[model samples]
Target: MITAQKREESLQDVPIAVSAFSGAALERAQIENPQDIQFSIPNAVLVGNDRFTLRGIGNNAISSTADNGTQTFFNGATVALSPQDEFYDLERVEVLRGPQGTLYGRNTTGGAVNVITKRPTSQLEGFAFGQAGNFDSVKLQGAINLPMGERVRQRFAGYWLKRDGYTENLATGNGIDGREQFGVRSTTEVDLPWAVTGRLTLQYFEEDSSRARETKRLCKAIAVLGCSPNELGFDSPNTSAVIMQTLLRSPIFTGIFPPGGDIYAGAPNPQDLRKIAADYDPKTEGENFIGVLDLSKTLGSLTFTSLTSYSEGKSKASTDWDNADLPFRFLRPITYQLGPDRQVTTDRLLTIDQFTSRSRTWSQELRLVSDNDGLFNYTAGAFFFDSKGRSRFEIWHPAIEFFTRAIGLPAASQHVDNDTPYSRTKAWALFGESYFQVTDATKLTVGLRYTDEEKAIRTRSIVLAAPTPYVVAERDWQEWTGKVSLDHRLDLSFTDETLLYASVARGYKGGGLNPGNAVDPDFEPETVMAYEVGAKNQLLGRALQANLAAFYYDYTDLQLGQRIGANAVTANADAKIWGLEGEFLWRPTENWLFDSNLSYLNTEIGEFLTIDAANPAQSLTTRTPAVPVNLAGNELPYAPAFKVKIGGQYSFGVGDWTGTLRADLTWQDEFYAREFNTPNDRIDGWALADLQARLVRDDGRLELQAFVKNVTAEDNIVSSIIEDALIGSYRNVRLLEPRTFGASILVRY
Candidate 1:
């Protein structure tokens, strides 16, 4: 049974394509966070920190007022932002792969991910676990539950994890992509009179980590260096500096690497993967505080529920822009106005870039649900959300002037840019869903939601010698979306556990104002109409279970990102997609189980026209390349044509212990990283294998496990960034972890 439909029902009865994982399954699969869970789900991927994509649709807008197409929920309340916390002491994680806007609220055009935490128990319970792994990785987790009197209970859970970087930096003789993080959660539950219950949870998490390592992959030769692109190596400062200087002289480097190849000095060679020549290691730090409250009361077969939540998050990061260990600079005199007078100064070798953001959000929801025994069952809810945030980004370098007198300006003109942006968002929605039992073997379901949202943005850009400010922009959006479906129980002679369902749903995502771009600061809302048909069945005396679904989507006003000049701009487009998904589970014996999931998707850009922000006069469609090139006929980015995952688990009994072995393999078809559909955009598909072994005491008090992930050591690309051909084109790819082995021990009382 599952709660994906906002009601307790058999998984086979729901008309949605979903993947459910129990805490034990998560542990066995070695899934620790959102980024790790994607490997187990077909047609799903998480890229670039928080960009979660399902099928062929994703939202990558940088505007604070915008929301992700795939919404994430923690304990029935919206996470509001990225929910990438460590997965410890969790009950389960449910992933719905189709539009769920009706029940999940806003920003669910692609899908929804819900993380359910373990609740306080009425009896005393506790567990402790520890792990050690390669790269000097260490992890610790523990949880305790306490019962106070007969009506009160409390639970506390926390985890601490640390690991050394996998990528080596030759400049400092140290590692760069290391990870360090910790989190804690406390929960309190109370039973009141009149069948009322209340619960509150508070959580705090902090992360201090380095940037995801990226290496440059050349597609064209560098004429200035007198060598083919594949012959270059970024492992040393001297070698990279020479290539950097040569590439800087290329005419295509004008707006991209104007000063020279100095910015790419730290990028490592694709073949080496581990070694990079950088002056400084890029570091990122984050902190999050969250609180959630739930109150529910039952009265005469009716239940009312209220959920409230508040959260605050802050992060700061510093990066070495040039990536090289050497100082690469070509001094140039530029004139600017300081105060009321004109000044001149020579540009220095820009090096370090810093970025910081702080945000807070508050939300409340109320719901009324009717008991399911009646001929009709229904749930209605209202939600309100508000958020505010500010961010600062700056870049500068250290340099001493020797010819400041020759240029007419001061030597302290090292600030490349200083930008501060602010954003505010307010939204509210009313939604309801009802199920009607039309016949003994048939049922009908309908749902609707109405949402209203408002957004405001302000951007401030400051240069070393000039101040440029953009006008504050504000926008409001409203939408109405809903779903309808029919489900029928099949009467087969062999088994009664079969269901056929068909559904059509409309989902909506509100629009927002862009901060960095002044030419076109507003984008449109996204809307999708999806049609799906599916069958769920259990055969062979309930030993074999299978579910299949086919779906088509009409998606419009999709929010996509593209690099224009030095900034990234959000654009709207339309697309069409059709796909098929199937999941199978078989347990022929009491101790053996096998499972598999497969998906096939085909998508195309229907209408994608873009305006050149750098040149307002150019209006080029996605099918016609005028500025950033068109992508009208191109396949959607990140949507592989085929995906497969298969696994098997076996449990055996020993004299005084129980042993289990599990293994899984996932394969994906090649896909593109961008909309341009060029050779550089392609990311060839690959396969990964994972294996685990565990042993538990007969008394169930202690357990031990060992796991090996990516056993094949596949160094496949997960994401990439490509510059324009006119801007010294280059491809920077982020590769997956090679191979990792770990072991852990757990004790329970």
Candidate 2:
């Protein structure tokens, strides 16, 4: 069963295309993190850790105030932080494809992911699990359920994970991309009077780990000898001269290398994919607290439900934007006397970027759902949400302080630039859906939602000697989206059950401000009109299952990210997408199971003109303008044309223990990382294989397992991005994890 439609229903009976995975299924698939779900689900892609794409629609906005095209939910509540830490202690995960604006209001233009946690039962039960893997990885997880009298129940779950970094920092002699995380959750369920029930849950999570390192794939220093041309058949351009000139003046670089020496000496070897040359071995730290309350009461044939949630989190990070030990330039204003005249000059200082942010969100939802037994059933709901966030970004130049002290002058201010931006969002929505039985075998459903949202931001810069005025921006948006679907059950002699359905839906994502932008700071909302047809079948005495879906989307006013100087802003674009997906499961025998899935996607962008931020005329020094480029007939980012996965499992008996062996192989087609479709933005397709072996006691009280992922150790690039012109125009690529082998033990009581 799944809750893709905000109610309990058999996976095969739902008209929507959804992939559901139980807790046991996750364990078998070795899906230890949210990003792993992309391999198992059709037409779903996760970029980096926070960006998700479905079909061909995705959000690439770098601004914190921008909304995502895809949204995630935890126990019917929208998640405000990264969903990675919530993978543990889950009852099931449901990936819903296509637009879900009818039931899920905003920020669902691509799709929705629902994570449901295990509920407490009126019995005492507990389990403990431990695992150890390569790279000095260790993990421990446990959960306990307790019953307090006949009217109350509670459950507690916690997890701790630590792992060594996968990437090595050559300059700092330290490791990067490591993980150290801890999380705990508590849930309580109480039976109230008058057939009312309430469930309260609280969760806390923290992470203190090394930040991921990016591999530099391109350099823009034309003056440097031995520099090679990139895949675009272009050598370093004159735009890099300004950055090189600043580096030559920095005492920090002069002390290390000869004056006017090779600036590319700190670049990492291109042949080594897992090594980086960053002077700063930065760390990322974050903490989050979440609370949720759910209440429900049944009267007659209708059920009333209320859901409330609150969340707050803070994060700090420092990143090596250059991906090399190169100096970052920061302009400092100074005054000097020349020929008895006062002259003002700007000096370029070496600096590093640091970031800190905090956010809080609260939401409430009230709804009524009628039983599905009647010919006419309906659901109605109202939702309210509010969120606030603040971020502080600074460029600190330690070298400036050192240089000033050496010259017998007042210590230079460490901060060359400091920006603090505060953002807030308030939204409310009303929605209703109804189902009608047109015939004994045919059903028709329709849903509608109205959403009103407001977003605002205030930006302040503290670099100037005098106080600067805050830059404020605000915008409001209203949208009406809905879905209509018709499904029929076929009376077939050869199959147990078969369902055919067709749907048309519309999705919406609200637009927001670009805090510091002086021109066109506000962007327009994006919307998509989707059409789909699907079939779900159960055959061979319910031992075989097959599902197929075909969909087309008309996307308009698509939000796209771009860099204007040092600030990230959003722009509007248009696109069209179509895809076909298929899923199959077969159980040939009691001990054998086979499953496979395939997806084919096609995407094309409508004609639009935008600045090519990666190849500016003159970068850092002068903040030169960038040339505009036309993007037409270009494929969408992260939209693999072809993807397939095949897996099989076999079980056998070994005395008092049951043994199982499983293997899976997945292949994906090449895709681009940007709208430009340049050769440097393309990522080659790759295939991976995973194997697992399991042994369990006959009574199911104990289990042991061994697993290996990426058996071939393929060096695949998972994500890539082009740095802004201010950073010297380079491509940063993130590689997939290398081969890992691990063993696990589980105990139940």
Candidate 3:
């Protein structure tokens, strides 16, 4: 039983810090999406694919309206930054962990994932699945349920996938981050007359990819001068032999150089990272549509609920802004060319772009539940949300439009910039929760919530050589948030179930309009204040189970994110984080099973202010004399200081069929990806292992499975992309995902 509390208790009597999973325990741990459940929880990191960081609080805002702090809900509406593909026919997938802001709000500070789906069942049932793997992969999934005659019911699920491309792009021979996608869902349930009940759901999904593939790490060390290193010496960094001898005495770089060579070459195994030397081919496309509505009524002691939702999404992407696909200066030199009359000296050159986005969302909720078993019990709620979005960018460069048409200008000065933005948001909330049993074994719980928010923005920035377009900005903001909690239930004998909890939470993240600053102004709202303590247990007779938690966070105004040179700004900080968490589950026998989780984190950075995208007049106490960085004690960027997850599983029987085996191990420690902890923002420390085997049949449908993941092909890295070097370090990375093996089959009726 688990709903991570919206009511459905017992997961050892829920006291927070959750991690539920069903759908056959997510297909016996071959978990398919949501970044594979971030390696089974614990400190939960995952940064590059829906961006997450629970214990360390997350949101990496590259501006698309950046706002995240761990939030993703479905059955309770709100799927904002997208990264949910319905996970098949899920019927479970909670995650909870730290701060749920009195029933999910303020993006939960760092928690909330919920996603429960699977309804409509009166009788008839169905299932189907298929799989194939190894780079050229394929998968299919299915579900069905129907029954109309008596109280109605219907369900239908879907999935389809294809994969290929694990990198290998001899420049447009294509094959870079490949995968195709498909999705469908439909659900309906009804039963009226006296007690009332109704449900409805619809979904659709689409994806196309050639997703960005990065790999080019060079951070510093390159003292200029005819930039050397091209002949398979690709540990990258160095390339200026006086801008390649003045671009080979220009004549348009000797008619594009390449026949006697020198278009600023190098890369043909420059330390092969699945090979690359791009010229122009990077991709991504996305689509989504969703809808949900639910209703209930029972009224005797009370029970009334309503939920409504709508979502829309669209995306388009392009990248290859010189991730070393050669074409000139192989590594860095956005600008070059001086002599024999080509002139376009600096201010960086060589860039390519395309980006588009769209979004729409709507939500509504209302609830009132309480059908006690005695000593008070309750839940009350109200919530509403709205969203709208639009974004566009298209940057360009081609020898700076051939040196701005040989220095005459126009032709948009080689089009170096273009932007368009618009955004809107609205929110409201009111909530409550209560429980009290006082004695029989003592019990008490309390909660509260209140939220109000608003945001609006409009922007436009265009500078193809600046002559116009740089003004058309707008901003608006408003906020208020709250939450409080306490829970206790203890009467241990050896623990047959016990819980002790404490809390104080308040979270919010809203503030917008900063399209990389057109005139600079507006980038506030980022708050948090959380403190917690927890314990949950069940022993012996219940086959051991334990959960423990401790937390502290007093983050504020932290909308941090910086890049400066290529413009990606937002700042304001004051952070402090403290953590300790643990979880364990053992079954001993009855087919045996064991689970584990652990985390320890500490992060700090107090009072930080850095929002001078090249001096927007530099006034937050001014600083930035050509790069003077200080973010106090740092350490809050992907935060990872110790993290672990262990696993186990076993089951056996032969003749009539039934067998199982599973394994898991995950580790983490060493993380930084930014927040200016320098050393080029470290990122080492990795461990991963997974394996599985299963077979079943004894008149209970059919099943078969075999799996392997990350087995030891851990390339780690998971996120980075520095960029800011008129001539040397451009840094780029994003790895992980090497070993894989698969097999699957399932059928049910």
Against the reference, the lDDT scores of all candidates come to: 0.75, 0.79, 0.70
User: Model 2 off-target regions past 4 Å?
Assistant: 213-244, 247-263, 266-270, 326-351, 397-420, 460-468, 618-625
lDDT of 2 by residue, 1-749 (tens): 99888888999999988988999888878887876778888987778655779897768765667887888787989867565473788899998889899899899988988878899999899899999999899999999999999999999999999998888877788778888999999999999998899999999999998856354345434432122124532222233343543544666444443455434443444346777666566678999998999999989889899999999999887765445664333344433221112232434222346678899999999999999677999989999999999987765443333444445544222233445467899999999999999998999999999999998888765431344577887889899999999999998999999999999999999887776566767778989999999999999999999999999999898888876445567888898999999999999899999988999999998987887555544344554566678898888888999999999999999999999999999999999888778777888999989999999999998999999999998978878876544435656777778898999999998
Clashes within 3 Å, all models in order: 7, 0, 9
Instruction: Name model 1 segments beyond 4 Å from true.
Output: 81-83, 213-270, 327-350, 397-420, 462-465, 515-519, 611-628, 723-729
Per-model TM against the reference: 0.88, 0.91, 0.35
Q: Model 1, 607: alpha-carbon shift in Å?
A: 3.2
Residue-wise C-alpha lDDT for candidate 1, range 1-749, written one tens digit per residue: 67798766778878788888889878767788776788778788776545789877667665656778888777888765344478889888888988998988778998988888899999899999999999899999999999998999999999998998877877778777788989999999999887889999888999888854354333343533212223323332233323234434554335434553454344444346566666668788999998899999988778899999998999887766545555443445433322112244535343556778999988999999888676798999999999889887765433212222233445333344434467888999999999899998899999999999999988755433334555588999899999999999999998648999999999888897766565767888999999999999999999998999999999888777766534557788888999999989899999998888899999888767663322312211113344544668888888899999999999999879999999989898999877766665778898989999999999988999999988988877778665322223345567777688999999999
Per-residue CA lDDT of candidate 3, range 133-217, in tens?
7887888999999998788899998999888867677767876777787898899988878778988888889888776636444
Which of 1 and 2 is the better model by TM-score? 2
| Full-model lDDT, candidate 1 | 0.75
Model 1 vs. true fold: TM: 0.88
